[model samples]
Target chain A: MAHILVVDDDEIMRALLSGMLRHVGHTVVESDNGQGGLEQMNAYPAELVITDIFMPEMDGLEFLITLLEKHPDSKVIAISGGYKAVNACLSLQMAKALGATDIIAKPFHTAAVIRQVAYALQSKTIAYRRRAER
Target chain B: MNASQSEQIQNTEEGYPDFAKLTEMREELGDHFLLVMQHFQSGMLARPQKIRQAFQNNNPEQLALEGHSFKSLCRQLGLSQMETLSVTLESMGRSGQLDGAAPLIERLLAYGLQAHCELQKYCLACGKPSSVQ
Candidate 1:
């Protein structure tokens, strides 16, 4: 099980995602906003961060920028909803550019999320193993 | 335009050109989508002034909060169009480009309407009521 951080301004979405992650045997840390999420990342150091693109205090892109600056090895899963297609694509591209391992569109299924998270963790492990071998 | 031509136009413009995939995705996540849509519609109605005022005041914080909330709901519904627009608004809010956000906000509002209609069609097809109250 991976230690996951879920950051979103919406309490309901956070709760739902947390529940799903926990149900899949992953430990989840919740943050209501981007700043708090950043703080938690510094303090707790989760293996993965699933954050909504928009937020109060600090937006997801800002958080991502900071997260990458501080932790280059960080794995992020950027999520967006209620944005235009091109804009969402841009956000995803930005996240990928900044070091996010995967980007999932909003309104995603619990199964899909679980799969993505699992794949991310597995990929990280593979990369680590390869580096260690080198 | 004939029926097929109209369908093609609708598909191309909205970004989900594959009707079958869209329908399957909707069906696979119907309950979650409905819940998200309910919150989205209510949030829009409950905070129209707050949303508009945020844009007017160029308050990125307020816009970010509202956009984040809306974005979360959109994520749950898989409303790609709305989600993309929301991301732009979020970015604009982050950059303090309040003026630049208007067009994106308008696009988001339009996407919201389209999402509502699409949800209604899915609900009807699945014999579920469109009770997004």
Candidate 2:
């Protein structure tokens, strides 16, 4: 029911996430990377953002840093595949410190994705700032 | 914050992928299952050249990126064997140690080809005709 932005370097991830969101009746906007995500947010500001951590031009951690700086109220979800045992928790912890509202590990189930989106929407204050409301 | 990764991690015990998970996804996604698989064929597997180049050139950064992307996509589709191989490749690349990576890359390629065939057949049997190459 809310406008959501899904950002990831993977085209399939963008397609999969946007498809899932659309199935649940949420309007979705997709971007290939964080820089593109920032531009999309500027053009079609969404209430929620789901992004991936490792990417070419701009990674998710950097994006979270930038996004939170620009729109501190925006809800952000960071997704990462994580290498073996070494950077799984570390990567996510970095994301949290950088201001991601939530994080999702790669290869997640459909229900899990839907649940996180719902929780972020209902419990947390939205990231999208209406000009009039702000 | 630990709750963010509450979902169970799915991987295969054997050398192949668990298609049952994908079957469930097919039911939920219906026609859009085609789109996901299509991306698997076209978008995901479209760059073996880059992967090989990274591995051969000892470009740890590129190798890690390739491994990260490949394993992530494979896990999503339940291709656990390939996911396992890719994860190893990613770890090695991240650590800047490609020692013994040759055999791993070869196995990943072999498994990847098998996975592609299985996915093609699966999609064709799913009521919609596929133009897989």
The C-alpha local distance difference test score for the whole of candidate 2 amounts to 0.76
List model 2 lDDT by residue over A1-134, tens digit each: 99999998888888888777887788988889899899998887888999988788888889988888787788888888775464656888888777777788878887788899998877554344333377
Q: Report lDDT (CA) for all predictions.
A: 0.67, 0.76
TM-score between predicted and true chain B, model 1? 0.62
User: Worst ten-residue run, lDDT, model 2 chain B?
Assistant: B1-10
Best prediction by lDDT:
2
Cα deviation of A19, candidate 1, in Å: 2.0
Model 2 shows how many backbone clashes?
A: 1
Q: Give the per-residue lDDT digits (tens) of candidate 2, residues B17-111.
A: 56787786676566677887777766434544456679999898788888888877888888766766676777778888887777767766666
In terms of docking quality, model 1 is incorrect
Model 2 chain A lowest lDDT segment of ten = A123-132
lDDT of 1 at B12: 40
**Residue range A1-134, candidate 1, lDDT tens digits:** 99999998777677667766776678999999888988898999999999988665688889988887787677888887534334677877777776677888766766788789888876663235446899
